[model samples]
Target: MLKIGEVARRTGVSVRALRYYEEQGLLTPDRTPSGQRRYPEETVEVVLLFQRFYAAGLSSRAIAALLPCVNKGHPSTPQRHMLRTERDRLAARVEEMADTLHRLDQLITDADRRAGAAA
Candidate 1:
């Protein structure tokens, strides 16, 4: 078993973040007699996965719900439904971001044209 600090070093996550994961029920590290957290080698990969999920805008509760499906390698019906719902939400967010990018590009182009005219 690896110590908590080792897991944090390997995962590039802060020790506080690892503790928060435990508080959120996402990580469950074993405790030594002295009350220190000890993690398995696979925790590095799990923490990376958590990072990806967070980057994708998943809440801790959503991740907690999905963890079982991930561990089992096959989602049950409800889990599949949840996955689809989250996917659709992410797609919508992406579309909104694309629209914002397009607007920003237009503003930049218009500003460039105005500057050229002034020149």
Candidate 2:
């Protein structure tokens, strides 16, 4: 068992964020007699996984559903599907961003050349 602070230190997450995660039903920490929250060692990995998936645009509800599969020490087919779907969506978005960036770069280069020719 680890205290909330310990979990935060080990996981590089804020204690407040951990408490919020608990409130969101993402994590369940045991309360000590003195009211300090205790977490299992596995929680560090769980929280980090949550962070990565969330950054990848996974919703909290989706992550909540997926956590059970991970906690049980089993892979989830549904979560895998979701991840693949998310990957496709992100790839599409990245392609769009790349196109936009390419257009912007071309505009900047053209403007620079025009300015040099004028000079």
Candidate 3:
């Protein structure tokens, strides 16, 4: 078993985030006699998964809803639908980013043309 600090360092997650995960029902850590949190080695992967889910724009509630299916290794139809919705959202975000990049490129090109004309 590892202490919470060690787990946080190993997983690159903050201690507060781990505590929040526990509060969110996403993680369950063993408690010491002194009331310190101790976690198994497997928890590092779970923390990483949480980080990935967060980075992918999943809300804590969505992640919580998805975790049971992951733990059970069987996604129900609704869970699959939730995942599809998230995927579509991500796709939309990517398109928005691409559009923003294209606009920035155009601005840069126009600035370059103006600079050339000035010279």
Superposition error at 7 for model 1 (Å): 2.2
Ranking of all candidate structures by their TM-score, best first: 1, 3, 2
Any idea what lDDT model 2 has?
0.87
For candidate 3, what's the RMSD?
1.8
TM-score against native, each model: 0.87, 0.71, 0.86
Q: Give the TM-score of candidate 2.
A: 0.71
- Candidate 3: pairs in clash: none
- The better-scoring model by lDDT among 2 and 3 is 3
Per-residue lDDT tens digits of candidate 3, residues 38-119?
Answer: 9999899888989989998899999999997767879989999998999899999999999999999999999999999999
lDDT of 1 by residue, 7-109 (tens): 9899899999999999999999999999999998998999999999999999999999999987887998999999999999999999999999999999999
Q: What is candidate 2's lDDT per residue for 1-119, written digit by digit as tens? A: 99999999998999998998998899999988998899999899999998887887878887787777777756578877866687898899889999999999999999999999999
Query: Using lDDT as the measure, what is the rank order of every candidate, best first?
Result: 1, 3, 2
- The 10 consecutive residues of candidate 2 with the worst lDDT sum are 67-76
Q: List residue ranges in candidate 3 displaced over 4 A.
A: none
